[model samples]
Target: MSVKGQYSATIVIGVCGVGKTSVGHALALALNADFIEADDYHSAENLKAMASGIPLSDEMRLPWLKTLAEAAEAARQKRPVVMACSALKRSYRDLLRDKIGKVQFVFLHGDRDMIADRLVKRADHFMPVSLLDSQIATLEPPTSQEDVIAVDVALPKTEIVDIVARTMRTRQNADMTALNSEH
Candidate 1:
């Protein structure tokens, strides 16, 4: 996915298997930023729900999202950090708006067929492919006001990584240079 250049922190948001984790890692390496998977903090109940192919309600996701927000804040204190999360709804993202003000987002968006294909190829995740439909149904694409950069998930991994990295670096460098000039 692409990124809006000039933000210190970023969240890679997408449905499961849409390359959020993979792309987030690559972007972090490129930016020399820390990375986190939103799934790692999932409560036992949420895991059970997804494992059972049962989608979690907003009630189930709130705490998990908050944990991610805390992690984001902690990471930002040290360096530019990128967190991979399926921030599927506006409310979930809004939950972290204060903690992550002025944050940029890279949204990896694809159709159901593309998601299903990736899910089929992915393995070892607690969330099964059966839950993909549910996840898709709950997804809300970020709007213009969200300061988001949207990318089609069909792009090649290398190209996608290149696009995101270049955009991020350009923005970050400009900000640094501007600050240096001020100094």
Candidate 2:
């Protein structure tokens, strides 16, 4: 992983109950990088709307996403950053990439039944289980054109972290090789 001078930001994206926080923290630890929880950047209004079981409109989410992007950039000033965010739309991901250059993504994907089961067990979050469907509906899975690696949410957290960490290292190696070749 790039430590100081290189631009490195990894956004762990998925629906609400896909264990983004757990996986993100573990991945950050594995990479010796900073961990930024996107949920923490949500405005009070946004949190209220989510808690009320009302899905946020794209306009409502714009500020939150921009805040998260700024937070990632600030965190990256010290080291690489791993952030847990839904980033459910392609435009949102594009905005992030534009704000923070060379951003990578880990998409945690799973069946609705599996994710719903996970959401049922959560008691501390403001996001109601009812909103999962809306989020899933909004999600635009990363394509081959994006800098992304898809991982199954059903995998154990440890395994997921290991997989992402290894993949990140591989990507870093490839980037270095390409840079050297250019020189």
Candidate 3:
């Protein structure tokens, strides 16, 4: 799909090996939004460590997370954006909340076996399949009160994006209804 324009700023979140990048890319293309890979914000040292199968501490990840949040917010120049972030824990999502106005998250989830399978087959990335266990172990699914759409990662890539897009439209309609009620 051709790049068009950005859509509503959003977070495409999930554990490692859950196809966040691929699905996010598809969603961004469908919505005509710019996509940002949160991994790009990682430091060289962090990348090297992860490449060696080291899990980054929250302390080590905080600054990079903040940078990603800031970059995502900054990218909203009268257009929408799709940001791919692990956003494993609630606190991490909170850090990005302020920056992402009308933020919605597309959460991709799968069992350990499925994710591990994908990770094992994955290639040419700094994150190794060996580290999949660590990520799944650390992941904290989004709770109530967050704008989140959870999709099963086992679905084909196109279906995953379709699920998010359909859900997103529904969410927008819900929000509009609430706003109308408030007035």
The lDDT leader among the candidates is 2
- Residue-level lDDT tens digits of model 2 in 1-183: 343324469999988999999999999899889999999999999999999999989999999999998999888988889999999999999999889887788999998999998899998889888999999988899997887999998899999998988887787788778887777
lDDT of each: 0.82, 0.89, 0.82
Model 1 root-mean-square deviation: 3.8
Off by over 4 Å in 1: 1-8, 170-183
The 10-residue segment of model 1 with minimum total lDDT is 1-10
Clashing pairs in 1: none
TM-score of each: 0.88, 0.95, 0.92
Clashes of each: 0, 0, 4
Count: clashes, candidate 1: 0
The candidates, ranked best first by TM-score, are 2, 3, 1
lDDT of 1 by residue, 1-183 (tens): 113334646899988889999999988888789998888999999999898889999989888988888888887878888989999998877776656766778899888887888888887888788888888889998897876778888998777878887776676788678877776
Task: Report lDDT (Cα) of residue 78, candidate 3.
Answer: 47
Q: Kindly report which residue stretches of model 2 are placed more than 4 angstroms away from their true locations once superposed.
A: 1-7
Error of 2 at 74 (Å): 1.0
- Give me the runs in candidate 3 sitting further than 4 Å from their true place: 1-8
* Candidate 3 residue pairs in backbone clash: 5-32, 6-33, 6-80, 7-80
lDDT of 3 by residue, 28-64 (tens): 9999888999998999989999999899999989999
